[model samples]
Target: MNDYTGFPAAARHLAAMIRCPSVTPDTAGTLDYLEKVLAPLGFNCQRVTFSEAGTADVDNLYARLGSGSPHLMFAGHTDVVPAGEEAAWALPPFGAEVKDGVMYGRGAVDMKGGIACFIAAVEAYLEKHGKPDGSVSFLITGDEEGPSVNGTDKLLQWAAGKGERWDASIVGEPSNPEAIGDMIKNGRRGSLSGRITVHGVQGHSAYPHLADNPVRGLMDLLDALLATPFDEETDHFQPTNMEVTTVDVGNPAVNVIPADATAGFNIRFNDTWDGDSLKAEILSRLEKGAKASRIRHGKDAPVNYSVDWVGRVSPVFLTRETELVGKLSAAIADVTGRTPELSTGGGTSDARFIKDYCPVVEFGLIGQTMHQVDERIALSDLDTLTAVYLRFLEGWFSGH
Candidate 1:
């Protein structure tokens, strides 16, 4: 096998990737390095860049080793969130410094490390068994943490237009909370965020009768949003819930009533609902709250409120690909000697997009310190995770 076929090689590659400082929406250096690594492994590497008017242009890498069926696409991002106050880190965030078996870096577990391990697994598999009977590819995006526009979804579309078809996929998102093999994300909840804006009259607070207080309306709207539970529980997902992130009137004075109020909320929903259904339900509650709140004040004027969905609403999904999930679970158990739970408990991931193309699951290193000032992963975990991936790669291809 080549030097990049084990934990040591994987660690070396990971450190090189970390040193690139490929923060989200910026990946020129990282893509170059990846092409260098994949080119030797017989991959036809393509450096893909995508852009939208308002979002940052992102660089991504798509590398494939073969051109046949049972194609397995390994998807991940090289981008790391900004390492806030690099000086606050115990080790340089981009240094990829190793101390006493732990590698400290910005993308250690959140997860350039996962990508590195997958590369190592593929390298070993190739060295041991020659070429796979089918195919293998990497869809590495650079905007997983940014305004996720111009990233995985776009890159997938680009690849699809080129006639790429994936039988199954694995997203290298750090799915475990404590250990590398404790969990596997077979699905993810959908995300919906929006602004609830209530229009009101501006006047002195002392003249309450003359000015409508939109704060009251905002409260009622929020109450309706929170009053009824979206669901109790599902077979594979947790209860759907919403949280009000902000309630703002932008009023600077205590004696004045604002002209408008806005409340922002985000919902993490399950397969029981989709984007349109969830939106309809939220609007219904908002309308009900507006009407009920209007009656509380005994007013003739309609409650003036508008709801605007924000950004892109992610639809909920579950992967029922039995072989994909079952074999991956068996691989984890084979390597770690523990049965991993198939879960759908995470917030959201690019897996949400990959789900539309092929059945995808998430399994990677432990994610305890992801996005923190001193994000790091244990050196031992590098070996363990690579083993899991190695096992999965062999099992998946052989079983297929």
Candidate 2:
């Protein structure tokens, strides 16, 4: 019930939360801290913990202010990536020290800042206008920076089970690149990862005729994957791109050819294809590469290889809810005087999972330092973003 009212309150909340050191999959008392602040704002906050067989159990919070329709969800995560080599930072990674108008900390911009801004905006809005005609909920999770198995996805399911449905969701994931209103991520490209292994005979490198080098086959296969463009840029998305992450022969001796070669790759695909179609296309290219005799030189057994799709496939999606998207854009313009670009160019986020439940978009602070040695954000940016969210809330609730 302490005073959690204005921009100063927001800054204090962020610094306190950062001091908790809530790294990925660890609450570090962040959820408890959030619940205390939220309860004072008349929100019924529920803390839920989810666990799966192989994934870490994650703590999550769902705080709702009203029970009516036109529900607006402010989704974000408190968990942050580890602060590697803390001595490399200008200030302590968890200290949340503000110097020359900037606050340096692990989750300052990447997300804890976003949550702080939203809370401040909500508190300010409620103080002036009481409760909105509709609803507002905070879907904060602690598993976004980890395997994402027990975070927003499960929290949403649990909330829905309790008869909660959202009209729209905004994931505060630092979507802006250079400034507060530079961009708004309306959608995200789908992500798929796989590892391909080619099996071959092991022998001395000097005896070329005695063994087949799987590396040769791997090179051709990878070339096939990259040689052709998946598609031209679509209306709402960019062309699909694939990158080879790891190429391993695991061979120790320089003279010996390894029995197998493996290459791990990840693909960020556009709306041009789904998981099934994309997988089929990849297999077709691999088959073509295996049949090619460029490096195999005439000894062709079709390049004995196998591919395993790693992890879960994140489906491509675009949020075209005109009302939800338009109001958010207008809100940004109202606050920053800059028309935010509708972008879908970044890597995947929890929005991919929330899209299935309701229309979702992303907008938050600038993200030049996320996961870097000295992650930080300008304190001015936090205030500006909080004002923008406050404007959006006012416009959205009034319109509804």
Q: Which candidate number has the best lDDT?
A: 2
Q: Write the per-residue lDDT of candidate 2 for residues 79-127, one digit (tens) a residue.
A: 9999999999999999988888788899998799999999989999999
Give the Cα-based TM-score of candidate 2 against the true structure.
Answer: 0.96
Candidate 1 lDDT by residue in tens digits, 1-400: 1132344867988988888898887884888898999999999999888988978888888999999989999999999899999889999999888877788999999889999999989989999998999999999999998878889999999999999999999999999988878999998889999998999999898887888888888888889889989987799999999999988989999999889999999999988899999999999998888777761276776679998999899988889889998999999999999888889997888998999899999999998899999999887898899999999989988987
List clash counts for every candidate, in order: 0, 0
| Ten-residue stretch with the least lDDT total in model 1 | 1-10
Looking at model 2, residue 349 earns an lDDT score of 92
Task: Give Cα distance to truth, residue 349, candidate 2, Å.
Answer: 0.7
Under the 3 Å rule for N, CA and C atoms, how many clashes does model 1 have?
0
- lDDT (C-alpha, whole model) for all candidates: 0.89, 0.91
